[model samples]
Target chain A: MLSELDLSAIYLTLKLASLTTLTLLIISPPLAWWLARSKLFFRPFIESLVALPLVLPPTVLGFYLLLSFSPDSYFGAFWIQLTGSGLAFSFAGLLIASVIYSLPFVVQPLQSAFVNLDKNYLEVASTLGFSPIKTFYKVVFPMTLPSFIIAGALGFAHTIGEFGVVLMIGGNIPGETQVLSITLFDHVETLQYEQAHLLSISLLIFSMSLLILIYGVLQKRQKRLNDA
Target chain B: MPNNMLKFTLCKAGLFNFAAEINLAGVCGVFGDSGAGKTSLVRALIGLDEQFIGSVNFNNNVWQDDKHFVKTEHRQIGMVFQEPRLFPHLDALGNLTLAHNKRSLYTIETLAKLLDFENLLDKKTIALSGGQKQRIAIARAILTAPQLLIMDEPLSSLDAHSRALLLPFIKRLAKQIPILYITHSMQELFYLANNMLLINDGKIEAVGDPQKLFIDPRLSLVKHAHSGLLLNVTCLSWDETHAMLQGKVDGQAIYLAMDKPVEQEILQIKVESKDVIIATQQFPHSSLQNCFTSEVEQIEQISASHILLTLNLGKQKLLAKITAKSLQQLQLKVGQSVYSYIKAVSIIGEIT
Candidate 1:
């Protein structure tokens, strides 16, 4: 049987992942659309900046985030003034770190989908007397629904398994910032081999199951579209 | 008259620089060769290409000018593209519903029945054939209740049977609203266009009646093998004994071989220049059943071996292709009366 600490870690991980995924869904669409369609000279520069977390080490990102979230930094000072609390080692700060870490996972799929969309659909919708916003909702959104699902699942799953950024900024605070990965790490470090084995196996099964479920749903949807 | 006219003076700089200024009314057929900038002109007129300079004024409403531009949705113009661009995610009915505005000209049921596609509404768009998809696309455009309908080679991708089936529908729609139809086929031009615009190398070559423009020696259409004229004929009665359709052109009786009875009062028959046989005098004893006494209005040498003759059949004109040797042998001259014999089997009546 798992201890109360392990169960709490699982609950906190789910909560953090859900919130991050929701925030990303709200913000990433416009950003991805712009990246896909804009012709500005500095577009490539912005694209590279968005993709930085994909190649850079997570601890390197965590180190910078830790510095920025400290009480002395300008961002941390502003956040403290607004919320009446320090940002370092806090749930709010941990969420910010996880979002940055999982951004590329959510945004790349959406950008490619937007890029490859058939332009005739937009033109036809316009000729049919639909406004630009209405066209996006009616034509673009439905055509790219599969990409959205993939992006959400990837963002959620990636956030759930995060360890380096959470540890550097969240500081393993039980029932607060401490998540499944960090809990497993703590168990192994304390030489509690039995608990560590149980935690590792459970996480392995859970991640595999999530991925399989998402891919299965996507395949079924593709078949339905083709058959219908 | 200006209030109901479509006038535009547009210019664009690209691989092929395009420039045109014209005031058009009725169903204007835009004819050109491939790469003549027909699609580009349509894009500019419909506000799809923002780089075009100059202006477009449709029915006294300024669609585009130096400072202001109306978006495509607000221009109140319905367009049918070369290909059927239906939404695959929506069924046929759903696609139509998206374009059903408060001012729709016809209800969905009426439109489906009129277009003969009532069976297609519940089917997914991906499963529909090319012709079926195009029907739904046409229905969607009309459902918007636009002021002007623009069809850009809507039948170019369709098969002959589909083309035949859809022509009458388009003709019926033209009676309600002015249409700007783009096409490369002269048959479609003769069947649909009351006014014609000829484009070559991205410039307006001429604009006038299609029947007259088709025979103009300076235009490119005259150089084609199938260049011909359209004659307006009224069905008089069916000759049941001879199994032929009796019709009249310019008060002269004409006969046509048809497998079906005449369903319409007025019909247009295509007469290829090559199919016309010129005789110096009428021969009373011959197998040719239809003959007309026409006066030679003009004669122009088209090639080293061939000459094209324009004959006056009262108010209508007929073109005859003849060899230069025959012209010299017969000593044919302008203002001379000649007998023009057209075979009954060669004339096919086009239902209007």
Candidate 2:
């Protein structure tokens, strides 16, 4: 029911979203843990910086990212030297933008979970001869598994739905950086109403199903916790 | 210089200034009222609170000093907090398994059976009752094979029945390892503690035998209604016909009422000061069969109408609460001998 271009766009979108979610899951935990526990004077400043993407318009963030990715900028020049190519309009550039844009969605849930964790568990683990790493794996991880799930789901869903940032930096290159949202945009611009409707309905159905599955799992977990 | 001594000098500005250089054997009861920095002292001693300036040396190992500080896990100190502190995500068995090191003092099965919580092993921690949770906590602590065990008001939050059930387990553990027991209940101090450290206003008021500390006139323990002496008596014979046991304290014969015959040779009895009757001479043909001649060592006015008399009975000491009028009528004075008639003596527990 879909054209070849549409299929390719969907593939690219899935790859980007999966990679972004994985990257965020790897990096956000320690950052969120520090944000939740650190007493540094500048911790609030760092927290606000991480939360900036949540409130800022996607275009504003995309514009700055585009500037930083250009060949003339220091960051872009360094990246070009290391990767043997320019950053703008590339899949790498788009992934970097997506990860930055979706970071707060992953970090906020984890940070709140860490903050709400009962400190007595940590103390008990310490007194029981558990090292910090063992305690985190045995105690902290199991307790916050629900938060990790929510964070991963939100990050993946948010990256899948990204539009303006991908447009500003990725620039709709076929089979390279163009994703599902930009492909749908191109269809609507070319007066292809039938195709646009098909794509939109597919996206709507897929996103609704994803959200329903996530919330259903979360509700079951919450009921189990309450019953416990 | 002893290998088992625990020495500490802890000072926290605006909170407490505590210092103790004593060797605590068996159960050392840290006794104090509320807000007397008992919990603070424990937190400092165990390396939980690092804001204090102190030196804590346990079992010849330096736990904390000016330049070096050992983390709680490396200090080999097992702790049982007031709350169970069990991990809700883990079942009771899982929680116990987390503390199972190579140096564990007992196997998980042994600890579970000893603590009487084998049925609770598979249950979720949150689903367990308060007493069940505390039993699991105690088991987990012991499985760590710690050199010293510290219980910070572990039974204060339990019901009386739970406290009764757990006290014997704690007493049993004290025989194996030295314990720092923090409690506000003087009854528990007399029942379980051989050494007592009296804490008041964040300072060590006294540290010695709990029986002697109970009768220290300068301390507030003498003012408590349940203030009494814990006397160690050796059982000689059982009078099954009268449901009484004949025991000896410092070679003086004494009688105690018991519901059943006690098989233990050494029995500790709690004699409340209110239950002791002082007389100038031995009264004959009375219901009281436990009587002894003791010399008056000290007397302190407890209130306008009541006075506490410390009587020296051979090597043992006993406290008797009497009215000031009775003291004057009997003309009781230090160095004068009097007959101490124990109205009641409750068997605390068997001391191993």
Candidate 3:
């Protein structure tokens, strides 16, 4: 398997996961905040959509996103004209799929954290002459950082290990779309047990370490709050 | 723009329900039971309750009307909650400075030092004690230098020992700033409030000088804040010779000798109205040693059987709980002269 593969696949895998994790980080905060705080008329509908990926098969999300990004749809045509290409069969396409696949992993914890944040802090902050945005930034946001870290870590690791979603959309373009999970799949299909084992073990270690780090931080917070 | 006068009639809100007309520039305490609209009134006054329909007119500045509403940030008022909601990510100093708009008159260094938060400056909020966090919360509010500040049961979360320690700090802070302090504690009524706004069941039951209300018992709810009489005491030098607490009120010396001793401290003594009796003249040869010459100010009915009698005991006003029959037999009326007998055990609290 090592002899058959080039280094570009490895680089592409790391790049795709990092970029997807970053995009989710940028998008999830306000979405989670709104879901936690807002009472808009359409909030329930929007929340159900954000939660759809959690229960749907990975391939279903990939298929829908593929259609949304293909030239046949209105958005795909408009996006293609602007970006110069349809997103399918490309690294960007795989990144988009991974972000969707990891949506619940990031949003659920972040939303709960926002909801559980000490509300009195907001009241006190408001009375202290802080604007809402300032209170969120100075009070609510920092208190939710640990949750953000958990969301980001789970999202990054989940993306690194994703298979069905990326496979459906990106189609295993050798150097552009092939990620670590795809590489591992390819090795196992070809009966290269040793290379598959190495990749699988590495992914496992990464996920476990991320979870351990989250637990450590949460334990520290519990101790501090109890002592306080 | 004018300072606001907040009027509210609240009952449906889940947290608390009450009504009052709040006039700023002085301490207006909305004292009540824990769930009895104390926090709700504060929330409404500060624009935290969205469903509330109260009008707060600050001089010429009205925060809310029937249709137009001014947001909290635009209200320019500050509040201190029972539990200090200090930002966990920020240290004490950071919490204080975050609200400083630079155009404000107050200074952070002075507030930090005054709140005794200088030592806790770099400490995380989680690292603070209950007392310390409340101090930081108050200092943070003061740093904003708002036109007015509202406090909602701010000391209820604190233990009695902690409340005792912070009362002086709060007294000092409130004097320099106009604060609406809300608490059900009797001590707050006697020690903190200059004016009282009694709210019960979402209505303005009564509003007057706290001392006067206790004497009159205008509303049934006023009993909580007015549970005891307020007697002014000037320290008369600790009686080391007798090992007792000695103080003078209205030129009459009061000696309270327990194992614990403090004689020289300016404070107020609470005399529960129930532990008092009216005598035609000063009597002797009894367990009760506290006797004062007084005149009846008024006698009012508390219940079907009990009558609340108000007497001016020299410079201090005393309340006596007497039966309706006793009042009739003695012919006690307003301005009638008599001697009031107070059992020494009725002093439940000392407000210093």
DockQ for all models: 0.73, 0.76, 0.50
lDDT for each residue of candidate 1 in A1-228, tens digit (9 for 90 to 100): 789999999999999999999999888888999999999999999899889889988999999999999889999999999999887788999889989999999999999999999988888888887898898899998999989999999999999989889988999899999899999999989998899899889889998998899899999988988898
Question: Model 3: per-residue lDDT, tens digit, B221-261?
Answer: 54553344767566576666766677777887677654555
Give the residue spans of candidate 1 off by over 4 A. Answer: B17-24, B225-227, B232-237, B250-252, B259-268, B277-285, B293-297, B303-307, B314-316, B322-339, B344-352
**CAPRI band for model 3:** medium
What are the per-residue Cα lDDT tens digits for candidate 2 across B68-169? 899998888899999999998888998888888778768999887777788889998889989889988988899899888999988877765567667767
Number of backbone-clashing residue pairs for each candidate, in the order shown: 0, 0, 11
C-alpha lDDT of candidate 3 relative to the true structure: 0.74
Better of 2 and 3 by DockQ: 2
True-contact fraction in model 2 equals 0.78
**Runs with alpha carbons beyond 4 Å of true place in candidate 2:** B159-161, B225-227, B230-253, B256-275, B279-283, B293-296, B299-307, B314-316, B322-338, B344-352
B26-72 in candidate 1: lDDT tens per residue? Answer: 57899999888788888888988888888888878898888889999
Ranking by DockQ: 2, 1, 3
Q: Which of the two candidates, 1 or 3, achieves a greater DockQ against the reference? A: 1
